[model samples]
Every structure is written in structure tokens, then in C-alpha cells.
Target: MYQYDNYDQAMVDARVAEFRDQVARRLEGKLTEEQFRPLRLMNGLYLQLHAYMLRVAVPYGTLSGKQMRMLGHIARKYDRGYGHFTTRQNIQYNWIKLSDAPDILADLASVEMHAIQTSGNCIRNISSDQYAGVAADEVADPRPWAELLRQWSSFHPEFSYLPRKFKIAVIASAQDRAAMRLHDIGLELVKKDGVIGARVFVGGGMGRTPIVAPEINAFITEDEIISYVEACLRVYNRYGRRDNKYKARIKILVHELGVEEYRRQVAEEFAHMKALGLNPPREELARIAAHFATPAYESGLSDDLDRSDPDFALWVDRNVTAHKQPGYAIANISLKPIGGIPGDASADQIELMADLAERYSLDELRVTHAQNIVLPYVKKADLYALWKELEANGLGEPNLDLVTDIIACPGLDYCSLANARSIPVAQKIASRFASNGRDAEIGELKLKISGCINACGHHHAGHIGILGVDRKGTENYQLLLGGSGAEDCSLGTITGPGFDENGIVDAVEKATDLYLRERTEGERFLDTYRRLGMAPFKEAIYG
Candidate 1:
């Protein structure tokens, strides 16, 4: 994890002071809601349907044990007893009081975390693979580059107030674990012929108009990434549509301009920036890289983890993944249970995870976009005892990439923009799937639900996507099929009409049954959907 330097600490402290004054002014009637809107948004504070929501950034989804403890403290002290982790790997407190926001920011700053860039139409938090440093397939850790982008983009005068919020994700390997294809800008670290570089993909995003990202260029040398990214942002800032909120994302810009023209424009702008020496300094990047160098690994461990305990075996089989190192494995903590809320953790649970990170694993933990916690480096020898501790803490759920591991949004419960309650919908689906014990039989599947078309749940990328809409005050869910979250990414096609809230679970069950019956053995729902198309699932779901 990157430690905050004096400059970083000072910036956060100063911002807190500024916000403290702003909050005071708003309370004193010196600033109205209209006046304080942008100010609050810039600080990651939102006035939700029921109360104020404060979103705190967990940069690149990394959290130290102490930092996690502080987040737990905040959740317990200020708002509800729990916090919701977002798809971007940030956390949101849905019941915060407007008067206590500055205090919350202050508390977070004490732990070297903040809400900066977590919201607003600006450069948001930089995201990377949760399995960055430990993944077996990784060529390099992408966090260093992510940190560099974080520093350069924070409060950047040139691009801070862009046409819309900009999201960037970097992947360090051939496998797209970070879902890079769904980001505004996706960078893949690559090595070709002994030369290190990045493959840049621009103008890829999801919203009302979803587009699978198209590659702009391949194997751009390491030195060129910054300038290339700057060029993409510059083009978006200049020509991205601002007249309509729906058309403001870079994806629409790319669609309107055409890929060839967009590519040409980006190259021209990048060349100009390069000539002007506007690229990020190599020395600065190296400095950031030093902070994220691989952690020291302790050699020699037993892989003979106790599999006698069914729970332990289930966890080992489902939650833990192979690590690049011989003795270590990555442990995934599933947030979705049979009837549990998705992406939510109570204050006590957060504290327990933090403690586990310091004790059993390295002092490192990552929040995944799938709304799960990942202990990226746990020794195989320590697996049994670690599982015991996790089980005691209620953090050991043995479902990874399964139907029960749903992705959902705050929906009407917290988000004012939401049309229906996503959490309940997610919980119902998870329970239904688990009770049947058909999740493993169905194989790896992604079920994502969004409150609205904004797609915060990443419903567009799910193998089975559900979008909730409020029709005449009645909640209805629309199902879509053939959606994928992998390399050959594609948006889901809608299946028939919207279903009533109760009908949704049945509809999903029908869809899954169709896939199970149609798919060959060992074929995942995504693979079967790709092979057969939407016709089969649509017929089963509607007919």
C-alpha cells in the first residue's frame, strides 16, 4: 500500500479545513443548497433521498488494517452500523448527517483516506486489478501506474471539471480481471520483445448508451502512457457532448467522431503534448513505482491445508485462488450470502477483516469491484487457521464467481436517482439460488442489478443483467441476456418485457434453468450464452 507523504497529508488536511468552513457556512445560511452543490460534490458528499451520503475513496481498492478500523469507527459513530462498498471499490455511508460530513472527512484523513474525487464530473478514483501484486498471470503490478495517475489527476487544473466523470482502470496481465473494457480509459501493461509498454483503450464506458471499448493503440511504450492518457482527456474535454447529460461520456464522443478519427485526433494531441514536454516525468513515475514494489515473500509452505472441515474445504475450493508465489494464495471474502446484503459490511466486520489482514495475511487487503474483500497474500500453510478465524468473524462465505455472489447498487434505499430497491432484489435472488443448491451446478455466472439505467451495478456487463424500473409506482425488473464481463465484452440484449418484483426471481430462475439445460458439461453460463445466443434464454424466460 502506498503511504501518504507530507504533501499528500497536507492536501487532505487543507481540504478538510476548507470543507469545515463550507459546512459551517451552509448551516449559517451563508451558502444555500444551490451554492454548495458543487462544493459538496467535489468533496464526495451527496444529498440522497433520505439523508446525506458520504463516499470515501479507497485508492486502487487498497486498505491498511488501521485504515479499515477507522472506516469501521466512522460507520459506527456517524451513520448506520454498516457501509456499502461500490463497484468502483469506494465505500458509501448512506445515512450521514449534513452537519457531520466535515468531521467524517477529518476522521478519514486521520487514517490517510479521503473522499476526494469519489464523485463529481471529474477524474474519479483510479482502479486496478484487486489481485495486482499476487496474481499468477501478472507481468507487473499495475498499482504503481495507478498511483501515478492518482497523483497527477488529483485537483488537476486542466481537466478537473471535465464534461463528465472520467474513470480509468489498468490491468497488469492478459486476463482482464479489472473489467478494463468497461472503463473510460483502460491500460494493459504489456511486455513485447523485452520492451515494456501499455495497450491503451479509450472511449469505453457504460450508461444509457453502453459500448464495449475498442482498442485505440497497442503496445505504447511505458514512457508514452501519461501523454496518451492526457491526449484522450483533452479530446474529451474539448469535444465531448455537454448539452445533454446522457451524451457527455467519452464513449458517445468516440461514437460520434468514429474510432479512426478519434484515434487520429488523440495521436495528434499526444504528439503535440510530447513535443511540449507535458508528459509525466519519468523520475516521478519511478518514485511512485518504488512505493509499490513487490512485497517480500517468505518461502516454503505446506499446501496440505486441512480440508476435512466441509466449511474449510468449501472455502478453500471456492474462495482461495492460486498465487504467483509457491507458498501463498489469494483469499476472496464474499460479501453476498444466501440472504445477506451485497457490498455491505458492518463496522465490526470491517474491524475483524482489518485484524485478520494484520495477523494471518500481510498488512494488505483489496476491495474488489464485485463487492468483495480480497486478502491477496495468505500463505497456504496458514490457510486452515485463517479460515477458522474468518469463519468465526462471519466473513467466510464459500461462493466465488457463483450465482449467489450478486452485484447490486444502493438503489432507492440510498440513491435518489434509483427507481427501485436493488439490495432486496439482490438478496432475494441470492437466497433463491442458494436454497436450490444449483449455484455450483449452474457454474460461474454474474448476476448484476441496477436501480436504473445509470448502471452503477454494472448490470450491462453481467452474464444475466437485471435493470429495475418504477412503472406507476410499482417496481419492475427488466432482464437481459448474453452480457459478459470478460475480454470479448458485449452488452446484454433485453429479454421480453419487464417483470414485477416477485416475478423477477422466477424469471432469473427460468433463465438459469434454460442455460443449465442448454449448456454442455463444464460450460459456464457466459460460454453457453455466447455459443447459443439470446434466442434460447428469451424463449425460456418469456414463453
Candidate 2:
């Protein structure tokens, strides 16, 4: 719900004009592919396996109905008739024409959105809790902090190109909906002594070398968070490896330096940054915070819901969360339809989601880290009607956090970095669990799939993770267990050996079967895995 001012509008429009010139030059053969790679990447364009892909930034996963409608338009007119919402809370169009990139960006800029910083070595999109303002237990909305950091890092001269790509996530609630600890810098806003401060975690990432971010600062005042973050980045940028891409992440540097030494260097940098007055004035934060003011709510609204319809009641139970506002609910729209792609929403579905946001969610929509859409403030009275509309449009699925609700990256189908196909694997596994009604029985399983070890799909953080690998020129899948991206975050461990496509799906079911058989009362797959560890699950999966 943050509208772009004249300055913001000017910046985006200028970028569009600049990129148009660049694209024209490339098409005219004045620039070669190598010459255009970094330039195009800076604008969030990628040369995929089949065609060019464009990633549009959804800052902190917040957008208005107008912005969401424009995304649908871009998907419909420029690329194919669909867009893949990514784990970064961004959207990607796989079949893009190089010539149409500028037009698409222009269209995005019209709605106060741009693809800036969605790619390249600069700080990627500053993500936050999808339920930032609506969550009942949050200390404060995290969007303002996200936006402030966004403005600071957009084109910072010092951090234009880091050793590797950087990611940051902010969360206000105790729950880790944004996978805070998995980001390069994770900030959890906590209220202590009646003042909101941030608990900072640095150097966390998932890739070939997965690492849980170590706590750098136990608590830094809210006013000084920006300065603190800048300090942390300064240290990483100075010493982080640049020669080897595999060892270039801040996580690697932090691991080598040790947490204590990293903290010490950051403290020195923070001291210098504080004197330079890098943080914007208090009024600037207040100005940014003003843009995210809560919408007006109706007084004396009834909190009653009609549970006569079993399907509607089931959807409400699985796909909705309690809103801080009375008589309102946070409705989740699942993109993972049985046997369908996990995050690909057709242009029509996107437009319909935009309509629902305007009509029911105070003109705002949020994209979750799990690659789902969320209407943050749906009225309780409107649940049935909303569910009916979503069901008719194939958007209603009561499988939130269930076995069928999978998270997958664009594997060999789209990504050049992928070693195997992820979409087919995700599809088969979802269908395998859904056909026998087993998905409903196995509850709260966070399943994730990645085509390679880059871990773009976050396989390292799933309760049940599948990694696609190249085994002797054949696509093989590795099963992982006991991973989680929640408040209790931990990396999953690999099972014995790899399995072929169908074999892997069966292996996942076997792992789940062990959980179902061994779990105590009310234990989810993750809880059961932790309680029993990997021994039984490995035995079940391998045997």
C-alpha cells in the first residue's frame, strides 16, 4: 500500500528509458551477449534455458490491486500468459522477448513498481512478514523498516557490487514466516522496556553451503538499525571472497572469521558509520511509516461465520489466520493446485486475485515466501463468498502447510543453473500424495524442491526436501529430512542415496509414513522428525 512519490516515479521512469536504449542497442548488434549480460541482469532480465526471463520485484511482498493488475497485464501481453511467483516474494516471466522488456518495465513503473535490485550483486528485494501489519502478535509492522532499507540500498555506491548476491528479511512476529534466519541479514523487531529494537542476525544463507545466520547484535535500537546493517555489510564487502563464487556469500566469510571476530569488526564499522550520520533523520522514518497506515475498520462488526458448508469451513480452518483486527481474517490463496505447478498463476488468476484484493482486502495483496498470495484483511463475514469465488477460479485449496502444498524452483525447464527438472518432480509428488487422500492425513508438512544445490527452492529448509541432481547424466532426486524454516529453523540432512523420479516420490511418502506411524499426538511432520531424529526416517526411506 506504499504509493510512489514524484521522486520514486522519476527514478523508475528514468530506468525504463535507459533500459530501452540498452535493449535497442543489443538488438541492433551493437552489444554482444557478454556485453549485455550485466546490464540486463541489473534490470532483472535473465537468459533462461528456453527464453529470456524477467523478474519483477514485489518489495516485502506488498502491492496494491492496481500494481497486481499491472503484473497480470505484463504476463498477458509481454510474456506467456502466466507468471511464476518466486520464494523471494517476486514474480518471474519465463518466456520473455528481449525487445519487450522495456515495455514491460514501463508498464510496471506506471503502477509504482520496478524490477530494480531484483537481481545482480546489489541487495535484492527487502522482504518482510507477509502478515506484517495484520498479525496479532507482532510488535510492529515490518514494512516501514523494509522500505527504509530498500531506499538506502537501492544504489548505494559502496555496495553496488558485493562478493555475492545479498538478501535481507525482516520480521516483527515471533514466528519466522519470512525465513528470517536464512537471509544474509535477518532482523527481528522485538519490544524490550517498552521500546521496539531489532535483534540482528547476519551471514545466513542456503546454497551449496547452507548456514544459519549467527546473532551479531542481541539488540540494536530501532533508530540505529540502518546504521547497524550498513556496518555489517561493510565488513562482509571488505573481506568476503570475490574470486570463488562458491565461497563468496557472507555466510562463508562469517564462518571463516568466526562469530566473535565478525562481531568485533562490525562494531568497529558501526562506530565509524554512526559518526558519519548515515541514518536518515527520525522524520524520514515517520514519513515512510505514514504511507503504511492501517485502513479504517467498521465498528461493532459481528465475528460470526457460517460453518454449514463443510468445504468452506475446511478452507477457513486451513487457509486462514487470525487478524489483529476483530471480525477480520488473513486469507491465504494457495498456488499449489494438485498436479499443477507450485507458483505459476495464469494471467486470468492474477487478475482475479487483484479483484479480490480490491474488493475484500482493503485494496492490498501480499505474496508469501512460500509462493502463495495472501489477502491480509478479509472480513470474517465474507469468508464463504470469497472461498466460493476462489474455488470457482481454482484458487481455493485447503492445503496450507500440508503435504500437497509444495515449494519448488524453476528447474531445468527454465533455469540454466538447474541440473534436473523440478516441476515434474513437484507435480508427481503432489499427485502421489493427493490421489489416495494421504495429503489430508499427513498434516503440516513443509515440502520443498530444488533442481540443484544453489538451493533456490530452499530444499534445505523444508520438513521434507527433495533435491534434483545429475547422477551419471540421469536426473536423480535426493530426499532430505528434519528441515524447517519456522521459528525453530534448522537445515535438513540428506538421506542415504539418490532415487529416480518416481522412486523419489515413493521415498518421500515412505518418510512421511514413518512420521505418521511414529508421531505422538498433535505432532506435525517437522515435530515428529525432530523428536525421533533421522534414524527412523532414513531407515523408512532407504528400506
Candidate 3:
């Protein structure tokens, strides 16, 4: 994890002080709600349907055990007894008091975390692969570059207020674990003739208009990524729509102007940015990279796992992934327990995960884009003990990428923008599939739900997607199929008419049933869907 230096601490402390005064003014009636909207948004505070929601940034999704412990403390002491880990690898507290906002920011500042740039129409928290440094296929750890971008964009006067909110993600592997293409700017570190460079993609996003960003630059040298990104943002910031808030994202701009034209504009801006020496010196990146240096590993350790217990063995097979280092595994902790809310962990569960991280995972943990946690450096020998502890707690769910591991947003239950309730929909579906033997049979399914077209749950990228809408003042659900946020990116297509809340769950089951009956050997749900097309699934669901 990147430790906050005096400069970083000073910046955060100053923001806390500034926001403290802003909150006080609002409470004291010196500032009205209209006046305090942007001020509070800049500090990651939102006035939700019920109350205030605070989003705290977890840069590149990396956290120390102590930092994770502090998150638990905040949950226990402040709002509710749990926190919801989001699709962006950030965490949110739903019920927050206006009075305690500053105190919460101060508490976060103490642990090198903050709520800055989380809610505004600015470059939000920088995201990356959860398995960044430990993934076997990584070209390089993307976090250093992510951190560099974080420093470059934080409170940047030039991009302080863009036409709309922008998001950026970095990944070093070919497998798009971070949904790299589904970001405003996605950077993939690639090696060209033994020298690393970045392959840049621009204009990808999901909302009312979903798009997989087209590649802008095939390759920019290692030293030029930041400058190239600046150029990309500069073009969007210059020409991106300001009239309609709906079409303000860079993705929409890139769509209006063809990819070739967008590419040309970026190239023109790149030349100017390059001439101005916008790229930081190589030493600064090197200094940032040093913070993500690999941890020491015990040499000649056994790679064998004692999977004597069938239950533990099932978890190992489902939740554990191969690591770059020998005798190590990446153990995914599923926050989506059956019948429970997806991406949520109670204070005790959070604290237990922190303890597990310290005791078994090099004192470091990562939050995955799927709303799960990763112990990136777990020893294969200690797998059973770790599994036992997690199982004893509620964190040990053996479903990873299965139907039960759902992705959903805070719908009408929390979000004011939502049309229908998303939590109950997710809960019903998860409960229906919990005890069914069919979920494991339907392997590697990515099911996502969103309360509205905002696509906060990333429904546009799911293999099976559910979108809740308001039809004639009644809640309705739409089923979408064949979407993915992986290296092979595509948006899901709607399956004809919408259904009621319970009807949608049954519709999903019907679609999966058709898959199980028709799929060829070794075919995943997505592969089968892509092979058979939507007609069959639509017929099965609608009929």
C-alpha cells in the first residue's frame, strides 16, 4: 500500500478542515442545501433518499489490515453495523449523520484514506486488477501507474470539473479483471521488445448509453502514459457536451464523433501535452513503484494443499486461484452469502477479514470488482485453516462466478434515483438459487442487477442481467443476456418485455434451464449463449 507522505497528509487534512467548515455552515443555516450540494459532493457526501451516504476511496483496492480494521470501526461506531463494497472496489455507508461527517473524514484521514473525488463529476477513484501483483499473467503491477495517475489527477485544477464524472482503470493482464474497457480511460501495460508501454482505450462506460471503448493509442512508451491520459481527458473536457447532463460522459462524446476523429483530436492534444513536458520524470514513477514492491516469500515451500475435507476442497476449487509465486494462492472471500445482500460485510466479518489478512495474507488484502475480498498471498499449506475460520464466520461461500455470486446496487431501498427496489430482487434470486444444485452446474455466470438505467450494478456487463424499472407506477424488471465486462467486452441485450419482480427471477431460472439442457460439453453459460443467440433464451423466458 502507498503510505501517505506529509504532502498527502497535508492535502487530506486541509480538505477535512475545509469540509468541516462547509458542513458546519450547512447545519447552522449559513449555507442552504442548494449552496452546499457541490461542496458536500466534492467531499464524497450524498443526501440519499433516506439519509446521507458516505463513499470512501480505497485506491486501487489495496488495504492494510489496520486500514480494513478502521473500516470495521467506522461501521460499528458511525452508521449501520455493515458497509457495502461497491463494484468500483470502494465502500459505502448508507446511514450517516450530518453532524458526524467531519469526524468521520478525520478518522479516515488518520488511516491514509478519504472520501475525496468519490461523488463529484471528476476523475473518481482509480481502479485496477485485484490480483495485480500476484496474478500469474501480469505484465507488471498496475498499481504504481495507478498511484501515479491518482497523484496526477487529485484536485487537478484543469480537470477539477469535467463535463461529467470520469473513471479510469489500469490492468497489466490480458484478462480484463478490472473491467478495463468499461472505463472512461483504460490503460493496459504491455511490453514491446522487452520495454513496457501502455495500450490505451478511450470512451468506455455503462449508463443509458453503454459502450466498449475503442483503442485510441496502440502503444505509448512507459514514460508517456500520464501525458497520453491527460491528452485524452483534455480532448473530452474541451468538446464533451455540457448542455445535457445525460449525454455528458466522454463515451457519448466519442460516439458522436467517430473513433477516427476522436483519435485524431487526442493525437493533436498529445503533441501539445508532450511539448509541455506533462509526463512526470521517470524517477517519480520509480519512487511510486517502490511502494508496491513484492513481499518476501519463503523459498522451497510446498505447493500442495491438503484437501481432505470435501467441503473445504470444494471451497479451494471454487474460490482459490493460482498466484505468481510458488506455494501461494489468491483466496477470494465471498461477501455475497446466499440470501444476504451482495457486497456487504458486517463489522465483525470485516474485522475477521482484517485479522485473516494480517495472520495469513502478508498483512494486505484487496477488494475485487465483483464485490469480494482477496487474500492475495495465502499459503497453500494453510488453506484449510483459513477456510475453517472463514466458514465459521459468514465469509466462506464457495460460490465464485457462479449464479449465487450476484452483483447488485442499492436500489429504491437506498438510492433516490432508483425506480424500483433492487435489494429484494437480488435477495429473492439469491435465495431461490442458494440450495439448488443447478447454480454450480451453471458455472461462471455473471448476474448483475441495477435499480435504474444508471447501471450502478453493472447490469450491462452481466451474462444474465436484471434491470428494475417503473412501469405505470409499478415496479417491473427487464431481463438481459450475453453481456460481459471481460477482455471480450460486450453489452447485454434485452430479452423482449419486462416482468414483475418475482417473474424476473423465474425468467432467469428458465434461461439457465435452457442452457443446461442445450449446452454442449465444456461450454459455460456465456459461451452457450453466444453460440445459440438470444432467440432461444428469449423464447424460453417469455413463453
The C-alpha TM-scores of every prediction are 0.99, 0.99, 0.99
Q: Name the candidate that leads on lDDT.
A: 3
TM-score quality measure for candidate 3: 0.99
Which candidate would rank higher by TM-score, 1 or 2? 2
Per-residue accuracy of model 1 over 220-254 as CA lDDT, tens digit each = 88888888899999999999878988899999999
**lDDT for every model?**
0.89, 0.93, 0.94
Candidate 2 stretches greater than 4 Å from native: none
User: By TM-score, how accurate is candidate 1?
Assistant: 0.99
For model 1, the superposed segments whose C-alpha errors exceed 4 Å read none
The candidate 2 region of ten consecutive residues with least summed lDDT is: 534-543
In angstroms, give how far residue 107 of model 3 lies from its true place.
Answer: 0.4
Which should have the higher lDDT, number 1 or number 2? Answer: 2
| Of candidates 3 and 2, the better by lDDT | 3
RMSD of each: 1.0, 0.7, 0.7
lDDT of 2 by residue, 1-543 (tens): 677889989989999999999999999999999999999999999999999999999999998998999999998998789999999999999999999999999999988999998889999999999999999999999999999999999889999999999999999999999999999999999999999999999989999999999899999998999999999999999999999999999999999999999999999999998888877799988999999898898767788998999999999999999998989999999999999999999999999999999999999999999999999989998888899999999999899999899999999989999999999999998889889999999888999999999999999999988899999999999988888888899999998899999999889989888888898999998889888888888888776
Q: After superposition, how far is residue 504 of candidate 2 from its true place, in Å?
A: 0.4
Alpha carbon lDDT at 234, candidate 3: 90
Question: What is the Cα-based TM-score of model 2?
Answer: 0.99
Error of 2 at 258 (Å): 0.5
